[model samples]
Target: MTSKSGRRVLVADDDEAVRRVVHRHLEDAGYRVESVPSGVEALARLRGAERPDALVTDLQMPGLDGLALLMEAKRLDPALPAIVITAHGSVETAVDAMRKGAYDYVEKPFHKDVLLLTIERALLHRMVLEENLRLTEALAREFSLGNLVGGCAAMQEVFRLAGRAAPTEAPILLLGESGTGKELLARALHYNSARAGKPFVTVNVAAIPESLVESELFGVVKGAFTGAVASRTGLFQQADGGTLFLDEIGEMRIDLQAKLLRTLESGDFRPVGSEREEHADVRIIAATNRDLGTAVEDGAFRRDLYHRIAVVVLRIPPLRDRIEDLPLLLRHFLGKLGAAGLEISSDAMKHLADWHWPGNVRELENELRRAILLRGSTGSIQPGDLSPEIQAGRPPRGRGDGRLDLRAIEIPDEGLNLSDLEREVISKALQKTGGNQTRAAALVGITRQTLIYRMEKHGLK
Candidate 1:
């Protein structure tokens, strides 16, 4: 017998001998057993603060019979597992108890081993239900809109639009640069909508080969093509009554776009090599980094198909466009990567904020992960810890006058340390003028005396 030392079981029967025998058997099997002489007492135990993990009760008790007791226990805690004990020939009563939510049934004149095994199975069922509920709640919190992490106006607008469109069934079109979190937003929409309990399926149009794209989306019957051995369910059926997110939708072949358009319009699709048309009520959310309007004009995409899926369009801004959210993004990624305690040096943060992230949020997360690894025993991140491309910051943009444009500098909403800014400006000016204090002061548009005073105040050479 497996050691069930911590599990509690409640035994209820009108026969005092049966209750005593069951209590002793379960205690011998390492269960913390509670014995009650009647069904009414079992119901009282279930309503107590310390409810039992599993209940084993007799079906033919005099008052408040086992069926009624089982129903009340379930009402108190729907996940509580119960086992019914019926007379040897009372199979119908046992089946009725099962239909009303008993986990399993044990016939009277039952072997002690059989009763113990039934209780074990019921406890196991309770455990599985608890675990599934835990996972579902975790996913709900992880995909909640409040977890998206954004403070910039552009990002806030994206959040607003997504919230407004999430509960609707209208097909959505997500347009953004690569790595701008189109798939993440799609998941948030699905998990927050009416179809949260159903599956949220995803397919990358650009990743699949052109030859298999059609079958991949609409499924294939056995022997539909060469090397076909069994039927395959496609994304549409898999995401039935939920969501189907197509990433990089612009990469789909023009010929296949017509078929996709037909399914979107009529909710009917035929599997390959099958004459019968199957229907799936799937909500489509398609994303693309490419400009579909331009693709339509260039004959690279079907204009009619484009019109079908663009019911609600969302444009996720790139990282460079929403640099104000960098601090929040950094904190979010750090917490997620289990490096929340690590600090970022001012110089390192400046480089991160200045870089024009071509790969957007995904790339930023990768860079931070790499920095944490390279930081070794250090508790903080420095510029040297980052990738060479990031450490270089953004390349300088020059004007016709050949002077750097200080006006273009982006100040984060939280602002910066004025002393740090002054020191950096003085140091750069001195470097440009080759350590000549007079020319450096002139370049900085400050008097030589004031520049020297400020340089001394900042402890700059």
Candidate 2:
């Protein structure tokens, strides 16, 4: 018998002998027991400032019966765990009491051990419920919109759009570079929405093999395929009444994109090899790193599907564009990585700011982790603690006068075309780098894919 020393139990019965017997049993089992002869008096004690942890009441009370008392008690504290005591012939009433919100029912002439065990189980159930609630609240706070760290104008705009759109049922498309926090934003939206208590399922489209993508999203009936052995629930069904975050949506196969589009439009999808169609009320939040408009133009992505998921598009800017947020992000990551006490030297901070983070925030966090490990016994991180690429930094793009060193180019009286200027800069970068797209992209401070897109747009060789 586990000693429930401080646990308080309230016992109510119309019979004086029953109350005394129950009180003595509960007290002997190490519980602080309070006995009342009527449900009315028990209700009064429940309504008082100090409430017991569990309730035990007899079903046939005078004015307020056990069933009524149980309902009222649950109404006052929705999570209150109540157990009802009933006579041997009142098994049906005990069942009714359970339906009215009693945790369990104990028939008359029950052994003391039986009563104590039921109380123990009821308290355990209440403990589990409280723990789950605490965890849910903590997750809500962690993913709250206000908790996302960003102070730059670009991030502020992103936050503003997310705040306004989070409460809506419209489909959302997140566009950004690979390392931008698109998935984090998606979670924040889901956790803040009306369906916060429901599931939030995520699927990385690019990660799954092409052969399994369809079945993974829409599920499979048992024996639907050669080796599906058991019936499987898909991401869409699992996220019913909640959210489905499709990561790397651009990488989804064209055939599967059509299926995804159909599901989004109709909210009905047939599991692979299944004759019947299943309906799931799920909100879609898709994310991608590719330039979808270009993909649609190139006939790679379906235009109809693009429009469906892009009802509300939010673009997360790359780290380079929001350099001012570096300090805030550094502190945020350090605290998250459990190195909150570690400090960064001015030289190290300068290197971090200067480096063009192709991998964005994800890379920055990884770099911080590495630096923390290399910081050794030193309380502060120095420039040498950073990666070599970051230590080398980028060649100065600005002059001592705090202006871009574009003095080599002169604007003629007629003025030059900006497009021509852009083309020339890109072409020169490619020519200077021996047509190596990666190096050329680095010289131009753009992603290799972006450089290729521009080169194709300019009809560059």
lDDT of all predictions, in order shown? 0.86, 0.88
Error of 1 at 432 (Å): 43
lDDT of 2 by residue, 40-127 (tens): 9999999999999999999898899888899999999888899999899999988887887889999889999899899999999998
**Candidate with the greatest lDDT versus the true structure:** 2
Quality of model 2 by C-alpha lDDT: 0.88
Cα lDDT tens digits, model 1, 64-126, are 999999999999999999998888889998999999999999877889989888888788778
Q: At residue 377, what lDDT does model 2 achieve?
A: 73
Shift in Å, residue 284, candidate 2: 3.5
Instruction: Give stretches of model 2 more than 4 Å off.
Output: 1-3, 15-25, 58-60, 85-101, 106-117, 167-170, 237-242, 254-282, 294-308, 341-343, 376-380, 394-461
TM-score for candidate 2, residues paired by index:
0.74
Candidate achieving the largest TM-score: 2
